[model samples]
Target: MRDFTWHVFTQTGDIEAYLLYKEMHNLGAPELGANAGAEDDEGNVADEE
Candidate 1:
């Protein structure tokens, strides 16, 4: 989705597409951040059983 939005933004210079790409990038940033750690759905580390 981000790639598509970015492609559209580049091709047409649509401000909305650029904004959408920026918004999606910002929204996904935290999930990949440091505090996320190596945890699972139950908040358990991957190697701890």
Candidate 2:
């Protein structure tokens, strides 16, 4: 699923759709293997403790 979305993004260069796809994919598991206060896909940092 990740690979397919990435492939479509690379092939069409549609950043918006790619981002949306990523957001949707991540919705189910927001912190699969990420750390606390981790930066989001857009690189925005969360508040640190």
Note the Cα lDDT for every prediction shown.
0.73, 0.62
Per-residue accuracy of model 2 over 1-49 as CA lDDT, tens digit each: 4555667799999997699668867775342332433355335533341
lDDT of 1 by residue, 1-49 (tens): 6777788999999999999989999888332433443454456645567
Worst 10 residues of 1 by lDDT: 29-38
Q: Once model 2 is optimally superposed onto the true structure by TM-score, how far is the C-alpha of residue 29 displaced, in angstroms?
A: 6.5
Candidate 1's displacement at residue 39, Å, is: 29
**Cα miss at 25, model 1 (Å)?**
0.2
Best by TM-score: 1
Evaluated against the true structure, the overall lDDT of model 2 is 0.62
